[model samples]
Target: MSYMNLIKEKDYLKILIAGVINRFGDSIDAIAMTWLVYSVSQNASLTALNFGINFVPTVLIQPFAGAYVEKLNHKKILVFMDLLRGVVVFLIALLTYFQCIEGWMIIVATFLLSTAEAFRMPANNALTPVIVKKENFNEAISLQSSMFRLSELIGTGVAGIIIGLCGVHVAIAIDALSFFFSGSIILMVKAKSYLRIEHQNKIFTDFKKGIKYLFHTKCLMRICLIGTIVNALLVPINSLETVLCIEVYHMGAELLSLMGIFSTIGSIVGAFIYPYLAKRYTERQFIVSFLLTMSLFYFICILNKVFLNLIFLFYIHLIISYFSLGAGAAVLSTYSSVNLLDKVDESFLARVSAVCVSLCTAAVPLCSFLVSFLSTFINVSDVFIVIAILSLLLAVLYSIISKKRWLE
Candidate 1:
């Protein structure tokens, strides 16, 4: 089915709109939050710490959240989480507007936001299959991915303009409003309760079962490991992009926003192309090739003076690298979701998703910390090179593993 038809489904349409609105707000908030923290502290480590805090709560909460989602109403969980986040974010905006916000407050707010996210993510993932038809599932995911990128493109562009004109507080207030609007849209989705009555297991027992299933499923395990490694290494790169643009490139928020726009455009293109590519290549082939190519672009990005105009060259290289990374990410997300959905029972979906997401994100804080520590000792450019090399090694290692059928 076409993307239009997929969105025409009432439940899927609600979910899609809610997701897009939330992501748009999130994209704006991402830039605003990073800029706010960095501007306040003028410390890269603290900035990285702020980014790290967002994921740390998920690492600790997602498994439990997933287990509970199986027993609770997904819609209610989503709505409650959104409302909670909206309140917290708006409070933060008020504090900021009053000049009462502190650096630590941002970190605390991020942690709270992530706490809601820990449950909301798994619930959202589980809700998709229930609403979308089996054959249209992949299309729905791809469309969602495309919309995410499109939202990011628009949100980041608007954020840069807003921050340039009105400052971060206003941008944040907008994000807060987005959350409330997203919750209202989610309330419009009409789906039967996905609560599984047959499973009366304890939460810890369900968590354990999820972990056991993940490890026993070698393909899923391999994918999870690779994802974790990539996420860990990539966190620093993303967490420090503003630093790269402002500190290293001698630019301002406009440049940072431009980079975000270009990256999201690349992601949109990748998401748009995924369905066709999935038909032509095996998941292993698509993932390996994309990773390898993306790593190559990262290497190129490290060459600061490759062209006569260094800054221009950097922009060109960064855009290409982001494009490749976006494509790879889209493919990886689709492959992981489709494969896991087929492999795992529906009752276990939320728990499995939670565990997988947690595992993939577990090292983010530590890695962000590592980057912050390394920055104190090394050039940020040198850190980028190190990430590139590690990524290349990972791609090569995964290629060998695929060849050996270790991922089978």
Candidate 2:
């Protein structure tokens, strides 16, 4: 029999396309929402709060959501979440276009969107391995990630232009439409979801089991910790990028758009090169070395003083840096599960992935607030230096810890 018969290729392709369409909305919203909040309130704290609200539901609800995703039909759960998000986003788009949207309304929309995402994310992660053959799984995930980056590049670049020409409301409306389109695509996909056993054990028991699995497994736990710290350092730099480009460097949306493009180009390059690198380096060595290199690159980008020249240098640096980052991340994601896929079961997969993503998501808001507040007191360049140093330090610490624990 053909290998194609082993998995639902058509359904997988639909899921990937749906992800791209949905993320176009996500890309626009990332810039538009922050700009909208900052425009209205003219306060850093309020903007930070918007980020905080976006993450709160995922942080609070993810453990339970993980357990819930395992027990349900993953495809149906994905569809329902997308539908809920589409409706919420469409309403926000309407309210925004009418100039009726308020700060609180924006925050509420973020909360709802994140809550839906909290449900959808774990289901999608679990569903992937179910639908794709084990041998092709890495390629599937890499393609998905590269597509996501492409969506980010296109969506954010377009958002910059649209926000400049038509304003934030139009961008928000487009994002809302994108979500609706994504939901429709999800509805078109068909897949066989594995049935979960009726474990009479408590829900917390399932949650704890996932946690215990993570903790007892040295490689997974260390990766999570390293990932969390790396994110903690990285998110603040991103939060400050817009402010740095516009306010400090006297650049505009055009340059910001260029940065997105170059960064994405780097990711595409990285994804393609990853398999080759996998053959050349051990996973741990590759991860730690790349993390350290990216940290240094970020530092150099900030230290370059010439505005236009800095952008050019940053363009090159980001491409290389992101390629490294993507390569490293793929290694970690693959290694997150060491054993045969069948033993961990779907619910366990959901729980572990949820917790990991939740922690990473939670870090962004906290770090954003820290970055914003720090910018008010110190130079943004100084903030970048601090972040770069922290990233380097974390990479070193992670290496030592991994070695001592025999995590490899």
How many clashing pairs per prediction, in order?
0, 0
lDDT of 2 by residue, 1-408 (tens): 133443457888888898899888887877777777766776655665577667778778887788777888787888788878878877877887788888899888888999999999888888878777766755666566667878877887787888889878877877777777887887786677645666746668878887787677665556566566556655654565666665556666665566566665556555545555656778568667756865875675575555356566756655565555545544444444332243455557888877767765677777766766776678767777887787788678867876764665
Go through the candidates in order and give the C-alpha RMSD of each one to the true structure.
2.0, 3.3
Q: Roughly what TM-score does model 1 have, to 2 decimal places? A: 0.94
Clashing pairs in 2: none
- Model 1 residue 227 CA deviation in Å: 2.2
Residue 166 CA displacement from its true place in model 2, Å:
2.2
- On residues 217-298, what C-alpha lDDT tens digit does candidate 1 reach at each position? 8777866766676677568668887777667766678877877887788788877777788788886677667667656755
Candidate lDDT values, in order: 0.81, 0.70
Residue pairs whose backbone atoms clash in candidate 1:
none
- Alpha-carbon shift of residue 248 in model 2 (angstroms): 1.0
